[model samples]
Each structure stands twice: as C-alpha cells, then as structure tokens.
Target: MLMALSAPALAHPHSFIDMQTTLVMQQKNLLALKMVWTMDEITSADLLYDAGSAGAGSEIWKKLAAEVMARVMAQHYFTNVYRDGKPLRYMRLPSEYQLSRNGNKAVLEFVIPLAQPAPLAGKPIIFSTYDPSYFVDMTYKSDRALHLPAEATPACALSLFTPKPNASMQAYALSLDKADAPPEEMDLGQQFAQKVTLQCQ
Candidate 1:
C-alpha cells in the first residue's frame, strides 16, 4: 500500500540567517527600526566568491547590495509593525543600508523609518519579522538581539516571543516549492516568526 502512494517532493530552505533588530525611538515616539541580518556560512560563501571573481574593489558588491535591498523592499522588508492593533506604514526606503562580508558570513544592515513617528506615551506596539514565502529561515540569535534604548523610551518595556510551528505546519512548510507563492491562507513564515512587543508609559 505504501508503494502505491506518491508524495510530492518539497523544496526546503537552502539558506539560514541570524537576525537582530533595534527599536529606534525619540522622546518616547517610535522613529524607525534598525535591522541586521547575518547569513550562514554556505550562503555567504557564494556571495564572497562572486565578489572575488568580479575583482578587488569591484562595484559588483554594491550592485548586489542594491539588488538585495530591492527584493526586501518589495516584501516590505519582511516586517510588520503595529500600534494599538493598527498596522503602521513605512515612510520611505531604508534610510541607510550596507552589505559586507565578515569572515565567513555576509551581513546586511539597514534602517527603516515609519511614515509618521508613533507616540508611545502610553501605548503598546508589536513588531514581527518573517519571510512570507519561507524560502529563507530567519531566526533571532539571542534574546538580547532585540534592543530598546533607554534614553529614547525611559519607561518602555520590551518582550520577545519566538514561536515554532507544530508538526503539521512544519511539514506543510517543508513541502512548499520555492517558486510558488504561499497561498493566502497559508502563512508558513508567520507560524515561526519572532515577535517583539513594546509597552510604554
């Protein structure tokens, strides 16, 4: 009976990343977000190899950085920000960004600003990061990866939540093809995303 069943092959993630984010606030008002993504050794190797072949100080690296930023911009930085349950909008492209090779890994850093700074006088804010297609695995390297500067929000508190998908959902995510967009009802990445909450007085 087992021989008679055919199971479709799934495309799993080939790249891994350790991510960190910092909430940027000014005078108790959320101003922007700072993010750092460090790619795993294998993935970084390919990028470094390409850069080397392009020659020393080649513009290829910068071009690659721009291309990468463009893709993430299309996906809204793979980020979701909410204040009091209302979604916040991105004011513009990343205010600052750079991509560089660090030893055996590649690191990307950028800052994304909000359309209008949200006052956190006494409100709660939620922020999450996930790739909707689940083509790449993004995880926080540690609890300390998420930061809030005390000077900007003296009375604010921060909490981090890292959720893992259950067996069924994990199986579903693993079976998805990279080329196919996940169905509307299936948010594979969201199931395993890291959530950051900020509460201020």
Candidate 2:
C-alpha cells in the first residue's frame, strides 16, 4: 500500500525553475503578485532549439507561450496565497504575461491579482509556489527573491521559508518518474516548497 500510494507521488518534476516574486501594493492594500521565473539551462536549450527549428520570430513561439500559460493557468499559476491561514482565490488570469529568452535561459513573467484585494495595514499574509504534481521544482533565487513596496517596507517584514526534505522524502522524490500523475491526497511538492511571509505592523 505504501508503494502503491507513493507511486503517483513519485512520478513527476521534469523541470526546474528559479523564481522571483514581488508583492504589489496600492494604498496599503495587497493588489497582486508579480512573478519572474527562469527555467534551467537544459530545458531552456531544448525550447530555444525548437524555436530556432521553427524559424526566427515564428508563430510557433506564440503557440508555445499560449500552451505554457494554459498549463500554468490550469494549476493556478502554481501559486498559493493565504491570509490568516485561509487560502485566497485568484480573481482572474494575469494582467500581463510574456515568455522570452535571456541568452540560454527561458524566462516567464506574469502578474496574478487577488480575487478580493486585502488590506495590508494591520495583518500578515503568506504565499508559496509549487507544482502540485511535483513535475516542476520552483525555487526562489535567494532570500531577496520576495520583494515589497517601499511604503510597505517600513511596516512590513518579509521572511522566506525553504522546507528541507529529509532523506526519506528525498528518496521518495527521486523515485518519482516524470510521467506519473500525482495522487489527489498527496501534496509531495509542498513538503519541499519555499514559502514567503509578509508580516505587518
């Protein structure tokens, strides 16, 4: 049963990403989150090679971008925002989105708005990024990856939490195959996710 249960959790995470996120605020209210993701060299190389084969400035890039965005949308942009321990819903798709390449790396940028903007004057909030299926590992570039507005900086403090998976968990994650579908009851990726918290005065 353990092996059967772990089967689905073990299949996935074929890609890696380094992510940077900014908390957008308006008049002390949380408005949206701006995200920048840079894909690893091998994946980036594959994408660029494909793009080149399709021809420069070809429509294939556009189609690829659309497909990528569609997959991300299906996963709620791989984001989870919370206030007081309750999850916050997304109002809609990103206001702005683009896919591009910087040398050998593929980059993705977008902004996701909250369903209902929350006041940041007196409370705290948390956000995290992870692929539920564990098919992609999303990691912050550094401690400075989470940015806050100038005004919010005075009253708000930012903290990052990177979960360290134990040896057993690591082995379990390593056992997963890229083609495996995640089990509905298991959120294996979350166990190894990085979280950003904004605490306000």
Candidate 3:
C-alpha cells in the first residue's frame, strides 16, 4: 500500500461518490441518461447537517437540489457524451431532477435528455463523468450500476472502462491543490473517469 502511494501516479481525491447511470431507450434508440450520484457520509456531512431540521420531501430538499443542480449545469454537467468519437449534445436543462437522502448518504438524481436521440441499433455510444480538478472522485459502483432499458438489452451490450492515467497525468493531478481549476481543453477529468460504452447491433 505504501509503495503504491509513493508511486509516481497519485490523484489525492478529496471526496468520493458512488455513481449509477441508466440508459433510457425508446424503440431501440437512445433518449436520455438517468444519473444518480451518492456522496459518502463524510462528504455529505454538511448538507445533512443543514437538512437536519427539514423533513423528507420538504421544500428544503427541493431548494437544495436546485442550488446544487445549478452548479452542475454551470459545469456542463461534468459530463461528456460521444458517438463514433464525435461529441453529442444535450438539452440545457434536464427534464427531471431531485436530491434525496438514503440512509447515511445524500443522493442526486437527474435525467439529461439528448438534443436528439441516437439510434443505438446502428452504432455505439460512449460517455464519462467526473470532477475536472480531481478534487472529487466520481466512480460507478459496478457493471450493475449501468441500468439499461429492458426493451433494448437483448440487442445491446454495456461495459464500463476505468482508465489508467499515465505517469505525467497522474503526477500533474497529484501536484495540484483543490483551489486550482484545470484548463478546459485539458479535459483533466476524462483522464481519470470511468467511461461507459453501449453498443447495439
């Protein structure tokens, strides 16, 4: 463990989230992605503390969800989608969104509608989500984390690919402080995020 820590590659992630993604399909076509991000107890401590007095399904939860979602929107949802290496577009606002608590964790759920649904029966689609600066580590809990529409599963296959950052990239991520913002073009988050690929043929 010590040796691995001392290795040239280190990210020093400050916060962690267990993520799940659902591919919403219609007639074998991709429509939107339903995302759920569950923050660890320690990371959600402040939010939970603030909501300590608020009851479930109260306006407080709704208000907090909007506030957090606004930030997410400002960051392009901290997400990227592509088809055959070309970037895909998404609606500026999600059709549905909310924040809720489960047990000891805070959960964020949202659905990002595609500007135009793609035909999955024709090609593969790929996507990834992460914090560009590496301050927050976003990871899928497992292959099961990616839920597929039942109608499309028979003809589709899904896989999650966790990337291994090269030495230089790892060093750069580890050297940075939380206050620093990565350059937009670098797509620093992409280097460390787990990528999901969906194919239908």
Clashes of 2: 4
Per-prediction TM-score to the true structure, in the order listed? 0.84, 0.85, 0.87
Model 2 TM-score (2 dp) = 0.85
- Candidate 1 structure quality by residue, lDDT tens digits, 3-84: 1111223464546778988888886689999999898887676667767755433588787677678877877888899887
Worst 10 residues of 2 by lDDT: 1-10
| Alpha-carbon runs more than 4 Å astray in model 2 | 1-12, 53-61, 179-182
Expressed as tens digits, the lDDT of each residue in 36-148 for candidate 2 is: 98887766765676667554345877766666677778778888898888998886688877777777777778899988888886557889998766667789967788898
lDDT of 2: 0.76
User: CA lDDT of each candidate?
Assistant: 0.76, 0.76, 0.81
Residue-level lDDT for 114 in candidate 3: 96
Which residue window of length 10 is worst by lDDT in model 3? 1-10
Runs of candidate 1 exceeding 4 Å displacement: 1-11, 53-58, 176-184
Measured over all alpha carbons after superposition, the RMSD of each candidate to the real structure, in angstroms, is 6.6, 5.1, 5.8
Model 3: lDDT of residue 55: 79
